[model samples]
Target: MADYLSVSALTQYLKRKFDVDPYLGKVFLTGEISNFRLRPNAHQYFSLKDDNAKINAIMFKSSFQKLKFQPETGMKVLVTGRVSLYERTGEYQIYVDRMEPDGVGQLFEAYEQLKRKLADEGLFSRPKRPLPRFPKRIAVVTSPSGAVIRDIITTVRRRFPIAQIVLFPALVQGQEAAQDITRQIKRANQIGSFDTLIIGRGGGSIEDLWPFNEESVARAIAESQLPVISSVGHETDTTIADLVADVRAATPTAAAELAVPVLSDVLAEILKEQNRLYLATSNLVKNRQNQLNRIRQSYVFQQPQRLYEAYLQRLDTASRHLNQVMTTGVTDLEQRLQLVRQRLLAESPTRLTHDDQARVSRDTDFLNRAIQQSLQTKRQRMERAVQSLDQLSPLKIMGRGFTYTTADDEVMTSIKQLHPGTKIDLHFADGLATATVETVKPHEEE
Candidate 1:
């Protein structure tokens, strides 16, 4: 019993020793993970082991959040961390800082991880953009030595010789391939010459085709402003890059077909349109000719003089009818005038001038005698009537000792209408006497 130490003191000493040790400070270890469990809080706790040796490991929540894919038991992983002692548990373990998939280099896992993520984000939705129908310049991202580029070139040339093909000359496989493809895509965008991008490679195994499945490449395709067509691996082969791409073709030649339009087909379409135009023009001309022919065959158009001839004949007929009516009217008027003259002669007293004048003179002498006798008789009767009227005249009566007494130019016949002092005039045959009314008399007659 040289020196007995408490477990706490012992563990503390060991923890300090491990923490300060140079060999255990930082390490890179390759092992298969065991007893791995993801905590509900996202921390990872596992054991890294070989056939004979094992050590406890922990991935904190923050460091675990950085991993693109989930880890499982028995997964081969390369971990970099420092060996440290847990003071509380008095256990030795490795605190993992960084991790990568061992056999697959973590790229595949990252590819799958990104594919699931983008798929969840709807990047692989069917609403992908359509490729250009007539691309003028097509950019290709593939090895310049491969049959993929050759096939694309030949297909594009055969389909549309007018389309210019530019090669981006990128690596198609291995570690550097993904970065190369991404760089070239960016470079092509920077150059800004190509109208469309065709990213493709010859068909290969999954390992040989791993680069195209990279998340970086997928993201590059997704972020590209220009349209991209992805043709990688075999027809059945699918990749994360293909999912994020604008269009996915089965083959390199298919991608070329998608990029450009067929010149032959276009020419055929134009020729068809031209033929239609020619037919339309021909029909128009035919219709016009038919119209002209119909016009020429018309009666008025064929014999223009017939119109004037018919009008002149109508005018002549009208003139003859008018002349007949005038002649008949003149004859009837002449007969009427003669009959009227004869009737006037038969009924006229002035037709026998001597007899009429003698009769007129006798009648005039008789009228003058009758008029004189009438005048003489009228004068005698008038004298007698005047004598009788004179006998009845008021002046005559007044001459026979009659006078009229008037007050205010009224006869004072009534005593009731007279006043005793009223001024009056007395009318006599010789003169009128002005006097005051002194008296009035009333008489009662039976």
Candidate 2:
């Protein structure tokens, strides 16, 4: 069996050999391309080689189309592929899953590294802002020319023409692209008044879209006061701008769609609201009309006199209650008055006077003796009080040889108060005399 191995068996054994080898199964390769050519609608056939070695490499059409750049012969490349043997040719080649120029590959690695860093920083975890329902203006940051601006304009106008498009042209690619995009973002913020911002370009290579992945652009997007929508490259592509922006649209036109609603949809909503209002108003009016009809057809309105009849019935019941209350009260009062009359007759003043006449005579004699005794005691007390008063009287003082003298309507108690020519009235207990003060003598201190 070892000496006579069939071609199929040999190829199959080699296929298994290449498949089973851990180093060759999947590989990371860096080399210069040789004999590389892009084939139309077919897989790419090329050779990857350095100065010392060479290996056949093939990228299927699906993988080739996904490359951001076209590969050329003698170009430095980085590739990821798996080693496999061609069944018919029995030749082992690398089936490349991904390939890129080494410089671009490094940039892509940087992109991924930065992406992970930002993710860890939670810059991508923030809640996305909501686009305004009816934005007054939408700011666009991109090159003024190209399909990006055109498609955005077309979509925005077609969907909601009322919202104005404010263009802040920025370099979307190049070394200064990140700075330009950052400047435009800040400029848009300075101008204000925009409810939404769309920053991006159309489909492009990784280098072309690199500005969107730059840290400056991502920081600007994260800091935007207005809701930012990122529309960079095609549907399959993503960038740091897309992660930080409030919304991500696959295309510029999609960004426009997100920025505003369809006019007809808004019209329909307004129409629905109008209809609801009309229905509510109609129902309210109809219910009120029904209530008014019921009121007009009520018994009170049908027979106008019945309204007063209810009041009359109530008045009659009240009148009967009042009569009953008054009659009961009068009867109670009469019974009470009869009891009072009997009590008054039993205690009549004239009968009492006759019954108590002899007792009154005896009480009167005793009362007269008591009155005489009380009068004698009171008279003696009064005479004592009168004698005390007489002792304090000025007439009593005059009897004791004390007199009151006056001059110029002033009492002169001291000789120094008298003036020689002053006329005064001398008052005594029994008499008054008009006299002139002839002289005044002051006694010596000794």
Top candidate when judged by lDDT against the true structure: 2
Instruction: Give the residue spans of candidate 1 off by over 4 A.
Output: 1-111, 288-446
TM-score of each: 0.42, 0.49
Alpha-carbon lDDT, every model = 0.85, 0.87
Would you give me the overall lDDT of model 2? 0.87
Candidate 1 residues 1-446, lDDT tens each?
A: 55999889899899999999999999999987765645867778888776577789999998888888777655779999999999888889999999998763243455567778888877787477667788889889999999999999999999899999999999998889999999999988888877899999987545568898777787788777789999997676777778788888999989888888789998998999999999999999999999999988988887899869989999999999999999999999999999999999887777678788899999999999999999999999999999999999999999999998887778877678877778888899999999876776767778
Clashing pairs in 2: none
State the weakest 10-residue window (summed lDDT) of model 1.
103-112
Candidate 2, residue 291: the lDDT equals 99
* Count of backbone clashes, every candidate in sequence: 0, 0
TM-score leader: 2
- Write the residue-wise lDDT of candidate 2 on 295-386 in tens digits: 99999899999889889999999999999999999999999999999999999999899889978999999999999999999999999999
